[model samples]
Target: MPPPSAPDCYRVPTTPSSGEFRDRGSKFVAVLRPVRSEAEALAVVEEQRLAHPKCNHHCYAYRIGPGTDRWRANDDGEPSGTAGKPILGQIDKEGLSDLIIVVSRYFGGTKLGTSGLITAYREAARLSLLETVLAERVLTSPILLEFGYALMTPVMGALSQLGLEMADQEFTERARIKLEVRQSEREATVKELKAAIAGVYLAEVHDTFVVEGLTVSLPG
Candidate 1:
């Protein structure tokens, strides 16, 4: 386990990589993808397992959130602590979060020494994380607003003025927009936005909804 008090930044790969090799006649193939949370990490692992049903081993690990959510790793059938921990350690070393990595081994006919196993797993994970495209640090906050096309221009303008990061905008009978307000300015900006379009808009906080893309929400 990495020191609990270790620094909080890590890197993760941006793209998936596949490599196949035979050790002593056994076939091994590794597939790695960046993942954000345990749920996402596990989902990818399961998906790959399903995709390669006959593979001998499917091991995975992931780190999510900020320092609050400590890194986690697992080795499916490799040594007890070998596969997952090393992969996760590399993530921590690279200061990465919200990423997942999985390695599949088919038990090559030749046994890779413990050291070989470690290197292969570590290299696979390292390469995967390295492929990722990273963004500068930005705090994200969730917000909901209700408006109509009658006020789209003003609403968008207010969004820019308030420096609120727009996430999702839905258009139907009503315009339902979601914002990822920067944490530092979220409260003040929300207030400012409300005030800016007070009479013209009907915005209110809504239940928390998690969607992909910069922002997304169902039109209200």
Candidate 2:
């Protein structure tokens, strides 16, 4: 079991995957995908709706962040907890996050009792995950770096030496840069930036932000 403390990386599906289940002529289609935020998750649901326009219910569950701290589950008109909860249960059972599972049900003119509905939804979610490739998602933090335009050269030198990349750079009388440092290395990186640019270049550390890496390469 992994420790309860925040982990450096979390498990997630490597790509979108789908599976289908049928019981009593009712068809349930499930798709699992990696999603970073609620907006993305909802967009996926919309896309699924477009794909399965004939489906009756589009139930779903999703979790975000390494800790799986933010999440939502929707039955989408299924009997109260019968659909959404079971799908979410599978996600939590797999110890996965930053992903969403959406199950579309096509009513086959037969009513599945509470137990049957739960079983169908759970099995649908499980089937999609069974075909998925799990991967480790690294954690990262974003820090905003600001300095006088004159200090660009020294700052660039420091970043190049550290093998760091700057993002969202804006130039004016003062220049602003956004940096994403690995969560575990953020403090050290911040210290290094200060040491290299603070006094000599009058660099100012205006703000700091935390974020997860959208993508990180895994060593072979």
Candidate 3:
């Protein structure tokens, strides 16, 4: 309910790490970084700049913090807005944050028109973002829940609806479940879980980190 209180952000990758493509006479180099903050994003840009000093320009954009909604973009030395704006546009279009994309350019002695430059930068940015790994983030409190098959329906249903994560589950005399709770909602959810299960379940609190997002388990 209420969008799970805006869980802390991680990344959901939509593209590969690095890709190279030619646009007109310019050589476009795109690089993707999984970032957690604006500072980290700037640091990455600096690192890239240092590494590629000979490149004509280094343009970048980043999003970080909760919901990964905070974002910034820079075109570096290209046009006033040509490079960074396109890169930022791609990031938003892809619904990605806590991430950064940098396009390194090596001029090839030809001038592409304004529209052509925009298209090239946009394409490079888009393709770079497409080459990354992404994950959903959730704010959670660490707790363990124990239950038996009899309580499965209600307990599982509640957990799923609340976006609780099962850190571990085992079936023995009873089901030993380690569930995560959001820090803001930890006390309330845990209490509700205990009360909801009552005699059918037992819960214990554990020291842990609040992680955001749910990852799909891959099949072997």
How does model 2 score by TM-score?
0.70
Report model 3's TM-score to 2 decimal places. 0.63
Alpha-carbon shift of residue 52 in model 2 (angstroms): 3.3
Q: What is the lDDT of every predicted structure here?
A: 0.64, 0.81, 0.68
Question: Which candidate do you rate higher for lDDT, 2 or 3?
Answer: 2
Comparison by TM-score, 1 against 3, better one: 3
By TM-score rank, best first, the candidates go 2, 3, 1
State the lDDT of candidate 1 residue by residue for 1-220, as single tens digits.
3333223233345666655544455554556666666777789888889888877778777777665465667788787766787787777776666677777777646788887777777766676655567543455567787766767776777777666665777789878887765566555665566555543332443334221122332222
Candidate 1: give its CA RMSD in angstroms. 8.7
lDDT of 1: 0.64
TM-score of each: 0.59, 0.70, 0.63
Candidate 2 off by > 4 Å: 1-8, 67-69, 144-154, 170-177, 194-220
Question: Candidate 3: misplaced stretches above 4 Å?
Answer: 1-11, 14-16, 67-69, 141-180, 183-188, 193-220
Top-scoring candidate (TM-score): 2
Better of 1 and 2 by TM-score: 2
Leading candidate by lDDT: 2
